[model samples]
Target: MKKHNYSAGPCILPQEVFEKSAEAILNFNNSGLSILEISHRSKDFVAVMDEARALALDLLGLTGKGYQALFLAGGASLEFLMVPYNLMKENGKAAYLDSGTWASAAIKEAKFFGETVVVASSKEQNYNHVPKGYEVPADANYFHCTSNNTIFGTQMKEFPNLDMPIVCDMSSDIFSRVLDFSKFDIIYAGAQKNMGPAGTTLVVIKEEILGKNGKTIPSMLDYAKHIKAESMYNTPPVFPVYASLLTLQWLKKLGGIPAIEKINNAKATLLYTEIDRNPLFKGAAAVEDRSNMNATFLLNDEAHTPIFDALWKEAGISGLPGHRSVGGYRASMYNALPIESVQVLVDVMKDLEKKVSKTRL
Candidate 1:
């Protein structure tokens, strides 16, 4: 049986994406060559790269808006280092918001470049909520924030209005909803989440945001250089990019972000409603800031853990355990996760409640 996948990343992808990616792996473009063996510079792979980049921008409504989308290696972790290197001057400062583990990791990277100021943080609250009413220093070179906290299950409902450039790490929730894509000068996400599998990280940057930092950025670390190379700065992650293109094509066929957003909202509502209505479980994050992509919850009584765990597993659920920092259960409802899967989990929850009630009798 195909289990209901709730793994946070390298997570679920469309069934069709799996089917198509597998075919390409064996016989890409029917070229009689495995996707793995093709040259990155080959016309076939170059067209794949070009379409993926364009489709990404087109979906985000960033096409012809002065933004160039690059599918590069090194994941979001590399972007952590590169963002500061290209945007922050030696003495210049940058502002960040700390909401979860990934955000904290980024803050650490930014500090290596120059003065890093944290505008506000919810660390004292164990990141159960996104920080609000915080101030971004106007003098800072740019303001950076993470759009979603995968581990903590919190998402930013709104972003800070800034005078300078705005950058966001949308790693865990990119392409899962509709947003004003043009509001930020730079947006980056690791493709492992909503976009595709691991290996390539997508960076959509407004071309005008490059340069003027006055810092000598190394070749690979420079956004302008990567854009000039048309994201072929070196051999790209060919297979991941191709798979991501398949997923994007699947998404487009499903009617783009506006279409998927409706389905995503429905799935989140179904699970969250059950969490709130069922006496056995409770949500881990603030209701106002709860993430539509990842929903973290816990049983009301820890002693009931084993029974609850067995019930879900028997019901074909997988990857429901929460992060180590937040021990409970996390239902990661990415773009490809169907609502039927969520209904199954809800049924299991109800079944568990009935079983426990009978035990008390």
Candidate 2:
């Protein structure tokens, strides 16, 4: 049976990337040495690291002047604390936008390091929408936000233009669209989602923003330490970093972010359109606030879930079940997901519609 992957994180990757990456794992660049066995300090591996960082900057349209890209070990979750640790001072407080689970977690971590002021939050509405019209503190260290919430399927449609440095967690939708990197002081994402396999996190930071906090930070949690060491302060996640490099190569070949954004939009539109039009299903998020990456929806009759699940399984569709927190179906349409996969899902929904009509008659 043909399989369509819709798993959220550590999600589906390009077949070509998997194929090439697999070959490298066995023997990288025909060196007769597996990529896993090579020394990270080796000249060959150094080139891989350099290319990966370069591709990230290139795809994000970040010129070398102010931005420095680093591939680190801990995921963006670590960055939650690191952002405040490096940016927030002894008396400094940071502003955070609480949109969903990840945003709240970030806020929690920031509080451990320093005072964190929640500038806006959608928790009152169960994170169904993005909070709007909140005042950002002028004296805050930096303002942090999650660009897209994977579980809730809501996105910050518009970013606030603020005088303070902007920090964003783009873990779920980093390269899924075109972004102005200059507007952000720092941006970080776990490689598992749109980038590559897990075990590595990508960070793009403004060079001038580091070392401002007088409080000493653990070397591992310090961005300046990772930057000076070129992300080799300690042993890095070589395999995941290499896989991310391949994904970046794939992204570049597909005409960079501009081309990928169109395809992403088309895929999301296909699934969301099906959900909106189908009587059996309804979208979970507000129309304007819907995420282009993770599309969350629910069955009209909750009891019909099992039937819907069985039908999709028979049709070779998988991983459409929503998160427990949301309790429905979530189809994660990341950049690597082909349009045809989404069409297959739409077809499944249409089939279910037919089945329901027949039973009613």
Tens-place lDDT per residue, model 2, 1-361, is: 8788888998999999999999998999999999999999999899999899988998998966678899998788989888998899898989999999999999999998777899888898888888989999999989999999999999888899999889999999999988776899999999998999999999999989888778898988888888899888998899999999999999999999999999999998899999999999999999999999999999999878878899888888778888998989999999988999899899989999998899899
Model 1 lDDT per residue over 1-361, tens place: 7699999998999999999989998999889999999999999999999999999999999999999999999999999999999899769999999999999999999998899999999999999999999888879999999999999999999997788999999999899889998899999999999988999999999999789899888999999999999999999999999999999999999999999999999999999999999999999999999999999999999999999999889888999999999999999999999999999999999998999999999
TM-scores, in order shown? Answer: 0.99, 0.98
Cα-lDDT of candidate 1: 0.94
In model 2, where do residues sit more than 4 Å from their true spots?
Answer: none
Candidate 1 TM-score to native: 0.99
| TM-score leader | 1
Model 1 poorest 10 in a row by lDDT: 208-217
Candidate 2: lDDT over CA atoms?
Answer: 0.91
Computed on alpha carbons, the lDDT of every model, listed in order, comes to: 0.94, 0.91
